[model samples]
Target: MKSTYQTKDFWAGCVYVAIGLAAILIAQDYKMGTAARMGAGYFPRVLSGLLMLIGLASILRAFLQPGERVERIQLRPMLLIVGSTLIFAASVRYLGTVIAVPLMGLLAASASRMFRITVPALVGLALLTAFCTIVFQMGLGVPLPILGSLFGG
Candidate 1:
């Protein structure tokens, strides 16, 4: 006997396929270019095509697997990810990189299994923040506002 059809996963796959197709169309309009030189839309167009392929595979998985457990999308993890993003967005502009990075780390850490994060993890997160800041601000020469010059800028 066939297992229960996963309606949510099926619909999500359909939506992904539709979105991928739309992206391809839009990227085409933006003039994705030749083999030697890529236009603004080239990578997006290629990525979207791959996405469409993956969506089809997912749709097949949802139906063809015998006695497959219905995949339940957990709300908690979703909420955690979404909440962290929101917090980062809200704080980034006002707080700036110096303060924002640590705050972002703290808020993001709350999303994990442990409400209180270990010092090592916190340190790791801080390093990630510093790496991102340096790469964007110094290496790429993009201006990221640092709230206070804690590291002497």
Candidate 2:
């Protein structure tokens, strides 16, 4: 008998399983009321159960279907993107959106091959910063400060 494999689907299924299990575990402490009187945990538990089922189906399909294998992961872009996100999360409170947004954009830009401190890049950064401000700050009413206490804004 020959063995069939689909690395992408298998890995995606594994990730879904992990996320579902984690959500289920975290929601265990909360009370799960009946379907009619839904508790805090009810929705999460139901969603997680669905996710688990989808993951199971995906895993089964990986073995049954003929699909491509997972491509090699790129470390540089991954690290830069992840690191920039961490920086944004950690510094958002201290640096505020006005400063943190541009910094995050620059870090993300550095991950790409066309990274340059050119006029176009600066314009793009400005546009991104404005969009973030309008969407997250003005539209969503997120309480993040535009300027931190250091700048006194």
Candidate 3:
């Protein structure tokens, strides 16, 4: 019989519960107002409460139902994805949305074992970059440049 502590659902539930509780605790410092006029902490507190409820349900389900054991973490894909995210954060200001988004997308996509650079992949990257540029830079008027200072924009 598989131990309850070894189940994937149990660990996932624990993670969710920890994060929810942390958020709830952090939110307590801010004032919570009525639903109609929510204060700074209201949304975080409400969302954290819901997250805690979901986590509790999952924890209960883990005890009631047999589940697969937690698998070993895949290092390559995890490192690639995390590295790409860090690169994106570090490069966004200098490279701007136009370059950084596609660069990050390419790096992230390469994390997949079946990843390949094809016409379709390139098109997807282009579309992603365009969407980010339009929505974040143009539409939302975020300060991110279309082309950054490095490109003399």
Over the full model, what C-alpha lDDT does candidate 3 score relative to the true structure? 0.89
Per-residue lDDT tens digits for candidate 3, residues 75-146, read 999988999999988988888888989988999999998899999999999999999888878899988878
Task: Give the Å error, residue 39, model 2.
Answer: 3.2
Global lDDT of each candidate: 0.74, 0.87, 0.89
Best by TM-score: 2
Candidate 3 regions with alpha-carbon error over 4 angstroms: 1-70
lDDT of 1 by residue, 71-145 (tens): 787878777677777876776666677677777667666767867777888788879878877898778976667
| Model 2 per-residue lDDT tens digits across residues 1-153 | 033353778778888999999999999999999989999999999999999999988888788784668888999999999999999999887888888999998998899998879998899889988988899899999898888766776
How far off is residue 16 in model 1, in Å? Answer: 7.7
TM-score between candidate 1 and the true structure: 0.49
TM-score of each: 0.49, 0.61, 0.56
Best by lDDT: 3
lDDT of 2 at 45: 96
Error of 3 at 3 (Å): 12
